[model samples]
Target: MPSSELFLIALATVLALPWLIWRLGRTDAWAPLVVVQILTGIALGPGLFGAAFPEIHRTVLNEEVIAMLGGVASWGVILFVWIAGTELDLSQAWRERRDSTVTAGLAMLGPLVLGGVVGMGLLWHAPGWMGPSASSWQFVAAIGMACSVTALPILILFMERLEILRKSLGQRVLRYASLDDLAIWGLLALILVDLERLGKQAAFLGLFFLATVILRRALPRLNPQDRWFLSLVWLALCALAADWAGLHYMVGAFLAGAVLEADWLDQQRLDRLREMLLLVMMPVFFLYTGLRTEWQLGGASVFAAAAALLLAGVGGKLLGLRLAGRILDWPPGQARLIGWLLQTKALIMIIFANILLDRAVISAETFTALLLMAAASTMLTIPMAQRAMKHFQDQSPEPSKLQSQR
Candidate 1:
């Protein structure tokens, strides 16, 4: 078959499976379409589909098909990260600095510490989790950050489902996640610091700072129509510079948006852009992500590792939030409710793990385990949050009413 024919088959398969499973299984409560798409990607990958239908896999997912998919996936993820960075309500976070700082700090610290300990244990028991180029500290830090991640976009979806997105609590949760998102990307840049490219990275930063100043002055003057075209050009340039600096292009994407004032672009436009990107481009990225999963450690071992990481990620998030709640004097059930919400980690964590794999900071087996942990963690979000909300309702009815009324 021609390469073009194969590419279309692969593309069709990627697009079709998600809708079919989502429609037939109706797994929205436990697994939303995004999560289902991710799972389907794994099922269709070399580890499963290729193993079961070797000839078919070879025919449809040939080298050309894979390369085409890779290009699409890369741009999809880069744009998605840029959108996330633009959505950071940092000014609002700073206005509510005390609450945001305390919560985000504790939330990040608990997972980092616990996940580091878990990484050390894994290193002792099975040393293959770290990549060939990774030092002990790099591996530990990457794993720790992975454990701490909260997928802000996915969290928004879940909150909307719970009918709390417009509520004050939902806004508060967004602030915390936004702050953590900033920290996560900052830490990633730190992790990606290559001694050989340190000069190039420094030069990139200096130039970027200068460019940001000019753009800040220029972007606001342009009509909204022109701003859209320039934004894409800026995004591409920033991503290229970041990649050249040995920081991942995704980091560059985030920085490109972060430096811009979100209000510069119309809020409706930003919302529409995000919706369209998720609706179209991000599924390709998810499928590509699934294709990268390796089962080299065997199914049982990989799953066991995933379970352990899930426990660390979820347990650490809850513990951290609980501690924060104690210090902040939150109401009896608020901590539990917020913890479950913040523990939702699907897209962002997968992106983080993919960067780790691309950098050779972690092996494919570790990436697969982290991906599983992310899916399971996200699946737990809605049901657990519902139960928490229910318990809170039962415990404090009138007060809840009064609060809601406020």
Candidate 2:
């Protein structure tokens, strides 16, 4: 390897150490340490100082290194998906179930409808703005699709912050979000397949579903020791296959999670790998995103449009959760907390935005704007959720449902 490459590797390790230390510090910020990694990366990676530190930057944040870092055992997320599927309180959703499923369904629907509607209306009112760029229905569908998503990791962080990991509300959000990801992935998969202009991929898409169904049934046949090893292998193979199939690796990830079948699996190899990811691999991923993402795109109008979309994203979620809380007659405090949490946008939107950007389905200007919108939405939401939960607590001093989460 070149001297520069070795230095970059050394730099990545040096920068990654703080997050590992922080993870051991017993702070919730440990979960959000990706934020920290990026700050450090910007200081180290090429730009101004990076130009001066060109050797350091090349090794650590260069295309090869970033790809490796960003790709850090993303299978950790895959394992999480598996754990998430197994941990689902289908019973809670079922026995107490009103069409809260429908509510969750509409929670997604309203946003999709609103996003597309807003896009069309804006273009209709102004001529030559984006110049027949985004159609009303396409506007509605894509943006709405983006808006309707809730990030799983963000929810996990919110729960960690509020100390609600074991509560019914937390469980509810996790379950609903899991369902949301499923629906969104299914739709996105279809859209992407269509975009690939690959009719054969369509058959393969159906095959992926059928294969997952068959594999879930077949997985149990392996002996105990073999099962653990084989499962990880299954994850790697499926993940790569999804990538090649033009489905971003999330489909494989979701399937990997959905198949785990038990909590015991988390305590095994998956747990160990997840720990490693949280310690080293994951922080690099975030740092990589922050250090690399271009922030300086677009004029005032694009910023305005992006801003408006984000507000709608946040508002749409809070409104949906609040409405559900009311209909369920959930304690006002808990209901309100739910509103905040629903704003915890997830990975789905970010991934979709990239696909749109990559396909030139949206302008680079619009793409950068929306990408920023996703990051901003994620940043602002954690606080929004925490405060909303707090507000509910203050208004209802009677030890309400929200408190049960703690």
Candidate 3:
């Protein structure tokens, strides 16, 4: 078949299958369309889709078609992460430092410790879990970080869907997630540190800091429209530079937006941009990621591994939040509900695991396990939070609900 025809087939399949399942299945109460899209991506991957229909997979995802999808997926993820970084409200986190610090600290630490232990056990029992490039410590830390991740973007989407994004409890959840977001990236940067390229990474950081200073001063003066374009330019530069420096372009894309003020961009426009990207481009990334999945460890083994990681991730999060509630004297049940929200992980965790895979810090089997855990974790978020979010909404003032809509 012609390259154009094959590309169209691949593209249409990527876009149509997930939406069709989401619409026809009507699994919104348990699984959002995005989660369905993710699962669909996996089904379309080599592990299942290729295994089931090898000829169709090859015909549709030829070299040229795969390359095209890869290019789009790369940019889609970079822009998505950039916007996530831009949305971070560090000032608000600092203002609510006492509560945020205790909650976020415990939330991350608990998972990190438990996940690290799990990583070690996996390494012992399952030799293929670690990548060739990864040292024992790096593999442990990377897996631990994966367990600790709270996908802020997915959390925001779920909160909005639950009509809690603007509520006081919702705002508080955002704060905790925001702080954890900063920590998550910082930890990733640390894990990605190559001693051989230490000097280059340091140079990238110094230059990035200088460039950030100039942009902060210059961006505020620009008309809103220009700032939008310029932000993309900055995003491109940072992504390219970071990839060059061995920190990975995604890291650079994140730093590019993390340094900028979110208020500088029009919030409404930002929201729309995010929605459109998720609607149009992000599925391409998910499909590409799914293409990387391999279940060489066998289906039962992979599922078992995923269950272990899920236990560490979800169990540790709830445990951590319960401890935080005790320390802060929260009302009963608050910690459990918040823990469920914090358990939301999809894109960011996948992004993190992708970095580990790209750097050969973890093997495909491990990546497959983490991927399964992310899908399962994300699937649980809406259903688990629905009851609590509704209760809170009923108690919330009418003005607060209106504010959330805005």
Candidate 4:
């Protein structure tokens, strides 16, 4: 009956509008879905209903919401990981091709190093928007690099829509994307462990990694049903451990993908799993990011800092990709695409930025700037990589020719 309580209910009801539209049979508009949901969350958050109807959010911010959101984020990530593992089928993918491997490696490397360097530089001339951050450049750079990197899930969706997943090159790109995701997420975990003290926070991940080593050896031969059950349990354990460590649930979710159910899970099961993620898991985590992001209205230096970081993030990935390709002796196109694909940043990095802000490791404006850079880089990389891939595919020889020669 309370006015604040009624406002909170109204906010939740408004957020339910998109799904209502979807259920009315219009799911093709994903871009609108994302925008509307995010905008709804923002309106409901402290900015509007929570401001005018301040009493509404007070009760809604209870422990239950946090716990539920935490669980959903955890499960969403696990489902994503499960799907990633399923995509590793290499029938079409050719790892023997020096060009593809070289391309993927370089592409993955470029933004990581570049972002790190730029993040470090911000320490020297503390931007007014960022205020004073307690964290060092190395830390900032690590988070920046992580944010600048791509999401395998989103990229895979693009590939599927293009009918590229059925192609040899597409399969290979997924392989490389898989590897890139592994390496970047791993780096993120290590950085987070260091941030929270490796001794305390790294223990579960280390254990999980070791378990992965064991599973990697056994999964190919395990009974299908057993593999499925064991993998789910492993996923659960990782989630619980991360929650216990006061780390983001995705740490466990990502590791679950990188390590468990890899060889055993197939398309059908993965599809079902993805349904759970899409329907129940990811929305809360992502929409919350949009809502909770603290926007500083007038911060020129923050804008400059954001721009600098974006350039560094993109440029670093490109640089790393080229260097990695050169060292590894990969072909030019493969190197280029890998670098581009790796530049697609998304939800994970934003999560890290929030953590940093929460811990007082960075200032409000700085955090918002980082998120801006992340969004811009993510938007830019996908189309860029697609174009690059088109050009590369055009230059490559047909498989039928090689088959005939053989």
Query: Which candidate gets the maximum lDDT versus the true structure?
Result: 3
Overall lDDT per candidate, in order of appearance: 0.86, 0.57, 0.88, 0.59
Ranking by TM-score: 3, 1, 2, 4
Candidate 2 vs candidate 3, lDDT winner: 3
Per-residue C-alpha lDDT of model 3 across residues 1-406, encoded as one tens digit per residue: 8988888888898899999888888888788888888888888999999999999998898888899999999999998899889878877787889999999999999899999999999899878999999999999999999999998888888888876677777888888998898998999999999999999999999999999999999999999989989999999999999999999999999999888877688767777888998999989988999999999988998999899999999999989999999999987778888988998889999999889999999999999999999999999877777665544343444333322211
Count of clashing residue pairs in every prediction:
0, 10, 0, 15
Clash tally for model 4:
15
lDDT of 2 by residue, 2-102 (tens): 64665466546645565665477543332345434434444443433465777755655566665555555354455554444444345445654574585
RMSD of 2: 5.7
Per-prediction TM-score: 0.95, 0.74, 0.96, 0.72
Name the weakest run of 10 consecutive residues (lDDT summed) in model 2.
397-406
Lowest summed lDDT window (length 10), candidate 4: 397-406
Q: Tens digits of per-residue lDDT for model 4 on 32-141?
A: 24334434444455545566776656666544564555555545555665456444433323545465456555665566666666666766675433334344753665
lDDT of 1 at 182: 90
- TM-score: which candidate is best? 3
